[model samples]
Target: MSRGRGWAADDGSAVAEFVMVNGLLVILTLSVIQLGLVLFIRNTVVDAAAEGARFGALADNSATDGIARSVDLITTALGPGYATNVTASTGSYLGHPALTITVQTPLPLIGLIGLDNGLEVSGHAAIESLN
Candidate 1:
């Protein structure tokens, strides 16, 4: 008599493998998106710093003006409340008048724990003294 009949071998087990691969792909895609956002914020902040430094390098530059310009540039480049606690100072670099601008902003991220320090951006440029 024939033993207990059993079904033939099947390849249906690939479904689980496919699902796992797709899940990994999805996670990778999200990670890429997050990295892009971080890069964007970094570039935007750098540009703002450069702009502020340039403005502060002008002939009629002052500490307040530098800070204001930095704030405006950062706010415009990023968005409202993006730049906060900005400080600008004047110093000498290579025996030339230099202006330094520092700015801080918070990064936008989901559950960005332990980031209470936020982000900081700064720029320094030689001031063109119109004497």
Candidate 2:
């Protein structure tokens, strides 16, 4: 007697493979997107910090000016929440005066949630003929 074609041992099937592969693909896609966002945020914040430092270092400006500029840039580029932690300071580098800007923004983990003070970046500029 020949076994019927429609009946076979019920075992692992196509559905299971599809589910596994699809889930992996979704995870990979999200991971790539998240990485891209983090990179963008980092670049924006760093650039803002540099700009702030330069502004503060100028003859007509103060550290507060740098801080404000940095905060504004960050707020415009990212959001208000990212702008709250910017600060600027003055010091000496290479035996000459300098300005520094420090920024702390949220580190992105699973969508806008990360450790407190998760990302910290700073920038410096030489004092420009402080008068």
Candidate 3:
């Protein structure tokens, strides 16, 4: 009789443990995926900024051109939302004239939605002079 009672008490414990473990595994998997997405977004934005700076540093290009390039690249790669805060200016890098492109974007916390202007990156390229 006592053995029968013990067996009954243990009957549903396996299902409960399974549910808890499965929940933990699912959360872990999602966390990893979200981290990967954040990294990918950061790298893409950085590359776009650098490319825009290089483009604007060309002898024939202007700072506004660099801003436009960055906006276009970001919009195409991510979305219009991520490209909204791009800016460009003339600056000096390593004691030489340069074009700088700055990009501010959201740091995604949950599925591409996150804090506004939480992530920022800049790119610089030496200005080309036709001397």
Candidate 1 residue lDDT tens string, 66-93: 7778778778876766676777878876
Q: What is the TM-score of each candidate against the true structure?
A: 0.79, 0.86, 0.91
Q: Which lDDT values do the candidates have, in the order given?
A: 0.75, 0.88, 0.93
Q: Write the per-residue lDDT of candidate 3 for residues 35-112, one digit (tens) a residue.
A: 999999999999999999999999998988899999999999999999999988887789998899999999999988
- Best-fitting candidate, measured by TM-score? 3
Lowest lDDT 10-mer window, candidate 2? Answer: 2-11
What is the number of residue pairs that collide in model 1?
A: 0
Error of 1 at 128 (Å): 1.4
RMSD in angstroms between candidate 2 and the native structure over all alpha carbons:
3.1
Give, for candidate 1, the lowest lDDT window spanning 10 residues.
Answer: 108-117
